[model samples]
Target: MVRFLWVCIVVAFCFSKWVDGFVQYSQRGDPKTEIINNTLMVSITLIRGAEAKGAVCLDGTLPAYYFNRGHGSGANSWVVHFQGGGWCSNITECVARTKTQFGSSRYMLPETGFTGILSFKAEENPDFFNWNRVLIPSCDGASYSGDSENKEAQLHFRGQRMWLTFMEELMSLGMRHAKRALISGCSAGGLTSILHCDKFRGLFKKSTKVKCLSDAGFFPDEVDISGEPTFRNFFSGVVSLQGVKKNLPRFCTRHLDPTSCFFPQNLISGIKTPLFILNSAYDIYQFYAILVPASTDPNGLWDNCKLNLTNCSPSQLQIMKGYRNQMLNLLKPISKSKQNGMSVTSCYAHCQAQYQVMWHADNSTLIGTKTISQSVGDWYFDRAEIKVYDEGCHYLVPQ
Candidate 1:
């Protein structure tokens, strides 16, 4: 227990931001990719309770952010992106993460290139390039929800505090006067976006247009192929160990378990703010962590299948198809929601918008012939009624 608590403190201390931890594509910021360099990284100036509450990373560093000022008519618009990486459920993983870019700011680059939703070039990011943009690094092992504070344990699970401090700083930088605002994140960051969507909307006046977008964040709470609830168990551990119950949405806690509220399926229905869900029905992360976790496949029965979808046997493919169906089943409620819009495709990948090719390129994956960027732009501006886009694997762009 002592070692685990120490690991937790180290993880929090060394925490840094990641662009998109699970991106499969590379060569970002190239002309072909259309992800240009536009934003500059800036370390946070004021950290509320940093000294007393220990809201510091493993290296005793503060959170770093990348911000770009808007110009022309976009001067009043703001978009904040929360960086994403997977979460650490145990001490070993958390301790190890603090040493890598995902957990420790010490190893992070002083500057990071902004692509996808953060793209500043009008040609590439057609709709939102000029909006005042901020990219927040998430080093908290708890998806910015943990609040456990035990000095004897030598742990500081203050993800909730960190988020509040970061938001306060951004608001001071001019988010409070924004005409329009959008909060988005990918993977674990995607989950954070969902959890904080309503709170973000409340930050501004009702007259201000506020919404949320989540990329590859709609993680389901279904049993894996092995008939085990791997993700649920993992979330239970996160909630219990980090004391995440206090940070969960009150509406959800009134009826459901705190860990259950962490999942988007249960959380979204309760959010008052409008939201857009951009995810793959066959999310690659779910394939690895939820569907066939290492704990369930201890003998490595799913080794090849997890690495390469093409290597799966006929029966395994059938199982994957069922999993996709389950995702659609889970999404049925949100599809009917008037306040929510979705672009869930059947691609066997995760975090598509982080790459320029998938965001708005000629060869970008399409949902009803519209690229992810086009769809999100149209939805954000209320250009048209955005509905859920799910055409199955046949419509998936060749990865």
Candidate 2:
């Protein structure tokens, strides 16, 4: 699965706009760097005084983010993006993550390239290219919402604290004065955007145009091929292990279990802030982890089919179609809301907004005539009420 994910990324990069430029590095306090080709490599900024606030990662390392200040018309506009990595549900899994960048800042690269929505090049990210872009790394192992600790394992599940600290730091850095602001994320980070959408709106004045974009964040509450609630069971473990129940939306938890509330399907309707959802109808992560997990297919019935959609048998294709319909059905309420927007295509992929090719390249995935970037821009600016859903499946093998 890891190899297949890299293949998808490499294929996306192949279709992306690449230019020639010099590589430059900056000192600690300075976060911005010149755009090298289409990618803007930004330095990481560890949250100041995070230890005092107990805002730490799984390994108790300080939380960090990469920032690039906006200029021109977008200077006052801010885009705070939550980084996405799969979550660790159990103590064993969490401990394992502590040794990697996902759970510890100690393992993170000093700097990372910002492409897709975070790109500085207007040609690559036309709408908000000049806006202040911030990428908060996913080191807490819980989509920035957990708030507990495991003393036995020496782990700190302080995702909620990390989120607060990061927001406070960004506000101090000038987000408080923003005329417009957007909070976005992909995968788990996408889930973070949904979970915090209204809270993010509360941070700004009523006049401030604050909105949220969740890319591939809608993890559905569905049964696996073996008729087991795999995702639900996994989420229950995460919520119980990390104490995520307290951070969940009250509107949802009031009636549903904390585990159910964790799924975006149960939380989207109550969000008062304008929200845009960008997801593929057949999200590959769901196909791999939820619908047909290795445990469920002990004989590896889906090994090849999961890696490539075209390799699926007729029955497998039927199951996939059912999954797609289920996702659309779950999104029905948002589809009717004028304040909300969506661009759910029948692509066999996940996390589109963070890739330059899928975001706005000439051959980018499209819903009707608009690329993901264009559709998102139209919604954010109120230029259009975008609600695009593709009827046909678009299958491609990574090469």
Candidate 3:
């Protein structure tokens, strides 16, 4: 126990240093921009009448999106992507969030680089390169599904309203006449894509081809290393504090609790729209935050392993394999669907579709011969039935 306590102290100090370095790095502009100069930067566009429509962010600031218009053969095609950041479960966390880009548009960068699936370059994003792309920021703290407000805290949980306002605004801007459309996101934004997939399809005419893609958003309701419901409890808090119950899918809320419905595992099967799921079998975020949180690993036994999968002990690797199997089992039902597509790789990373190397680089991560971009594109265009899974663990350092 004493050794464990010592490890904890060491880990804590290292974490503090990392956070400090991150702050300094952020001030210099997005680190990715430095590495990839060819990225296309798109400016933010705040909704004109969002405040009047009660479609404001957590701090009541106007909600916004970044858009890049399409051309030629893709002029009528649209890609709506949601920006992901972690959520705030309680009033204290929510209040803290209002000061950051996640909860308020005020802190967001005036312009952000669009890479990965949002990239406009044909070589980088072959299938959707020329398609009109829209990126909606997740600034309301509830995956764009909450609808209640806390007057005392001066918080506005109007994500649902904000989503509707975005749709209405985009329709007026040209989406209504789209020949094809796709809704996609990563992490929390990925959950938003799933939550609103059917609704997005309903917005277009029956002839318009529409589908949804969720990247690194399949958070399971499993117990942590300590056999405690850590993530479940956190999700429960978010649901209660944000009044998310009323907005959950009726089919799910009718049987399970609101917290359960928030999990993609319970909600994906019920989605009527064609959906594609892209996730890392050993998602790094889930490995640290959900499977073995700091509270669960007080001794810091997982400190090294969490940071680098290659550092894991044989026993730890076995445990991760079990977790991977669990995720695969949950995904079995969806894999059987001819209309749905999946790309579950054994990479120890999170949110792949948004990064250039992971999406379509020469050495990009792949299952069989298809890169992530190819898999998604093939599924989107019905070129093949993609239900590929990686059997061997590939501990590639996250980019």
- TM-score of each model, paired residue for residue: 0.85, 0.92, 0.90
Poorly placed runs, candidate 1 (over 4 Å) = 1-54, 58-60, 150-153, 392-399
Report how far off residue 14 is in candidate 1 (Å).
43
Worst 10 residues of 2 by lDDT: 17-26
Question: How many clashes does each candidate structure show, in the order listed?
Answer: 10, 0, 0
Give lDDT per model, in order. 0.76, 0.88, 0.88
Q: Cα RMSD (Å) between model 2 and the true structure?
A: 9.8
- Candidate 2 deviant stretches above 4 angstroms: 1-29, 392-395
**Which lDDT value does model 2 have at 219?**
96
> What's the lDDT for residue 326 in model 3?
96
Best by TM-score: 2
Q: TM-score of model 1 relative to the true fold?
A: 0.85
Please identify which of the two predictions, 1 or 3, would achieve the higher TM-score against the true structure.
3
> How would you encode candidate 3's per-residue C-alpha lDDT over 1-399 as one tens digit per residue?
999999999999999977754422222222222223666777788888889989899999999988777766888999999988978899999999999999999999888888899887789999998888888888988899999999999999999999999999889778999999999999999999999999999999999999999999899999998899999999998899888899899999999989999999999889999999999989988998888989988888988888788888999999998999999999987798999999998887889888898888888867878899999999999999999988644545553
Task: Kindly report which residue stretches of model 3 are placed more than 4 angstroms away from their true locations once superposed.
Answer: 1-36, 392-395
Q: Sort the candidates on TM-score, descending order.
A: 2, 3, 1
Ranking by lDDT: 2, 3, 1
